[model samples]
Target: MPAIKDSRIIILATNGFEQSELEVPLNELRKAGARVDVVSLKEGEITGWDKNDWGTAVKVDHTIADARVTAYDALVLPGGQINPDLLRVEDDAVAFIREFHASGKPVAAICHAPWLLIEAGLMRGRRATSYHSIHTDMENAGAIWEDKPCVRDGNMITSRKPDDLGAFVKAIIDAVEENASARVAAE
Candidate 1:
């Protein structure tokens, strides 16, 4: 992957985010030259989940209430049973996601993170994939769900689990790069 000069990426996560799911993709995106911002429901550090135990903490760059979708080129949602579950209940988080999608920006969610999409009402008629447990919920939300490593439908991308982080990151970087090029061409 090449450095994505001038591109900015936002990862929306909270406490209980799958450890590897957030770190791996964050590292990859940085290596690819995108400025990554870890945004959450609040300021301060957010904890990660490492399998059965708690993992490291990542500092939150901005709170959900302060995030402006127009400032970012892409969005990432890292999943854990608790992270997205908690995020979906926050009106601000859900609204932020809804605005990000409505703005036609690239949005990627891995594992259970797509639950935010369901909560934000952005899944209708869109094709997506998520951790196996939420397939039905995605279907119920009106999305054409698939069981794949990664699925990119329009500006949204989704993956199944931590194992899919590589694919998930690649899809998001590609989407952001493509979006950048398209915007440049249009201008």
Candidate 2:
């Protein structure tokens, strides 16, 4: 397993984000020694959507408008039916994701989350997987869609749905750890 040590991780989401989808992977990242920051569409706090009810609130460290792509090593986009769908329509969120990808930083998205990738136009020529319903959208975006637990292509990783959280979190951790190790070796 990869220990992040001092690596910095950024999670981007908004209200209605899938509760466990964000929290589980985030907690695991922190446990492995990564410094994780939660960002949102606005400042203050954001609520998560549990299975059929409201979930815990996560603090917002920065608003999408003020986010800088170069400040973090990795990015995570959590999904709920409404969260990423709303985010995909936000210009700042789309630009932030685009910049992050252009910077060659690891970006992980799960469930309906890859909708944002489609909006950012970063799915072209990449392999990804998401909730089954978005398979056509992903295919239309030029991504080679898969029906696997997780699919990783270069700095991008995608998983099918909330149930795939285990594989989702593991993929993010592995990406972060791999980057951390590479950075350490270069120093």
Candidate 3:
């Protein structure tokens, strides 16, 4: 069977998300046969940040107001300096992330995306990694921050930056497949 076949993955992002952080994982997950959706803070579309400038826009599959954590099997948070910074301050976004984490589903965050986990109060005691610039913020929030390319702690997975996309995406697929297998075994 394909890894994560029939699994539904939701990518939570907003304007100014890191381009590759979102696109690469989304593409990889879909290639692994998972149904991936881009859920944003607003409807219509969200633009990405390509290093120094705004990048291409991705169509929104669902808005925060309509996204329900139970509808999907996993969550993805793509980091850009502005994206997670904006999401961390949004009550609905933070609530959604908190609820998702509580569900015990897989959550893969890359680059600055871990900021949302910190804001949602889910970082404490978990081993994770993110963009080097935010190491202190992550540590102060009670997370065991590492400088590795990718780190997985239970249902949460994280990566340092774009260069870690391969490892990051693989972790996500592995987590999803493991979760699926667990569910089947339980049944």
Candidate 1: tens digits of C-alpha lDDT, residues 1-187:
2336679899999999999999998999999888999999888999999999999999999998888998899999999999999999999889899989899989999999999999999899999999999999999999999999999999999999988887898898889888888888788
At residue 161, give the lDDT of candidate 3. Answer: 95
Off by over 4 Å in 3: none
Point out the worst 10-residue segment of candidate 2 by lDDT.
1-10
Q: For model 2, how does the per-residue alpha-carbon lDDT over 7-102 read when each residue is reduced to its tens digit?
A: 788999999999988998789888878888999988899999999998989999988777788778899999989899889999989999999989
Best model per lDDT: 3
* Residue 127 in candidate 1, Cα distance off native in Å: 0.8
- Over the full model, what C-alpha lDDT does candidate 1 score relative to the true structure? 0.92
TM-score of each: 0.97, 0.94, 0.98
Candidate with best TM-score: 3
All candidates: CA RMSD in angstroms? Answer: 1.5, 1.6, 1.0
